[model samples]
Target: MKPNIYVVPRWSGTIHSDWYDWLAEQVEARWQVPLRRLEMPHWQTPRVEEALAFLSEQVPGLDEGTFFIGHSVGCQSILRFLHQKLTPESTSPNVGGLLFVAGWLEVDEPWDTVEPWLDRGTLDLRSVRERVLHKRVLISDNDPFTSDFARNKYLWETRLGADVTLYSGQRHFNQKTAPEVLSALREMVEPAN
Candidate 1:
């Protein structure tokens, strides 16, 4: 079977730029895989559960060993959602590897991103790390909200046992600047060991 990769962008991003249809239209010509995206708008609602629910619906349809590309706040939501689903008894057959782009492992209350994260409470962080053994945290070396990139990387690596990558001169890893994110997602779609 061909690969099925899900591109989950943050609350602030959109389908056109981050997961541009043009790229999909182009890449599909060669890969023949279904490269698609789902919108997670709970950040505007300021509720993490709503976004998690949206993601949960898709989890069932995804094939085993599916690739999940989560960006910014979507990364946090996916982790929390995964932890909720895969406790001890419950298991999702779809999950394979997690590729978190510009992932926000640390909970911050930025004026825009604060209220929604606060709604989920601090406890969710522990839940996510406890379950998300396979995770990658991509940090921007010059993120505006973060004071120190190394500090954030350390926080995620220590808390979630995440493999952190700090990309220089990038801010938030948004579509405007991070055009290479498409290639990054493609790489993660490789069969996981």
Candidate 2:
């Protein structure tokens, strides 16, 4: 059976209509797999908490072949979830791999859209940096969020040890402007089995 693919967008509840949805559909149709776009509740203080909670519930009783694709803040949420599980000494069976697109792991990133999440004591990036995982990050060389402070380039390199694939001109890899991400995602999922 094909693995379940979950795509987590940057913010919860705000669906920006563009190439992102189209790319996700392409993956489902071409790969013959179940794909879910897990939206965050909203860009608020509780947004990450809610997204993580919703994601945790969905993982129960899952098969051993689910994969996650996260963008921007969504990528950080994925790392948070994995850390929580590891801390508990529990294991998630369904998660097979990850496709983390341009993401900011640093709290001081200069975007107001993500400012509400900053200063939260729960976001421990250093731990995520060192913990090894079987996944990859689709690093955007020109992502604006990758400023020295936000340091996406460093995060992808040191923390993720990512199989970084370069795309020439995309900022943060958001909704409207980016490459056909589904194609890269399919490549990650299909060959693993």
Candidate 3:
């Protein structure tokens, strides 16, 4: 059976399922798999725990074949959920692979209102690194959230053991027509399937 694909949206973004519909179509066409765009409650101003809890409930059977695509704070929430909620002995399933788009461990100034969710102390990168083997981190050179691209790149690549793909003019990758996003996710999920 083809693995299930889950696309997690960025915080405060009104994407819902539209952002990933194109990619889902591509995946369904190629591999006959299904894509689920997870919709969190209070997405406009999401809390870390709330998002994580929602994802946890949705993902009761996360095996090594399950795939994930997380953007911005959605990525942070996924990492936290994997690190805190799932462990070696836990019944919750581990993911097969993950795609992080414009994902960050921290956010910039004036956006600190969401800092409580981005707290570094609560997340564990080691667990994330150990859980998923195929990982891709996509960031834009001009992303407003990630000021230091080099540092963030090194963090995701070296720390999380993910392949970092740098893009230009893709601010937080919030566009409705994101071709690169579709391609990258396809590349990540096709091989594993």
**Residues 99-188 of candidate 2: C-alpha lDDT, one tens digit per residue:** 887755664345665664443445554434444334677765666656442355555666556666666666566556445476666666
Backbone clashes in each candidate structure, one number apiece?
0, 1, 0
Per-residue lDDT tens digits for candidate 3, residues 1-193, read: 5778788888765444446676777777877877777877798888776887888788877777788888888787778777775666666655788888898876666365577776565455776788786789899998997788888898887678999999988878876667787777767666654
TM for every model, in the order presented, reads: 0.77, 0.75, 0.88
lDDT of 1 by residue, 2-85 (tens): 666677777666656554465566458757876667766644544676778888787665334566677776676766777677
The candidate scoring highest on lDDT is 3
Q: By how many angstroms RMSD does model 2 differ from the true structure?
A: 3.8
Q: What TM-score does prediction 2 earn?
A: 0.75
Native-to-model Cα distance after best TM-score fit, residue 7 in candidate 3, in Å? 1.0
> Which residues of candidate 3, in runs, are more than 4 Å off?
15-18, 91-94, 110-112, 119-122
Error of 3 at 25 (Å): 2.1
Q: Which of 1 and 3 is ahead in lDDT?
A: 3
**Top model number, TM-score:** 3
At residue 186, what lDDT does model 2 achieve? 62
Question: Which of 2 and 3 is the better model by lDDT?
Answer: 3
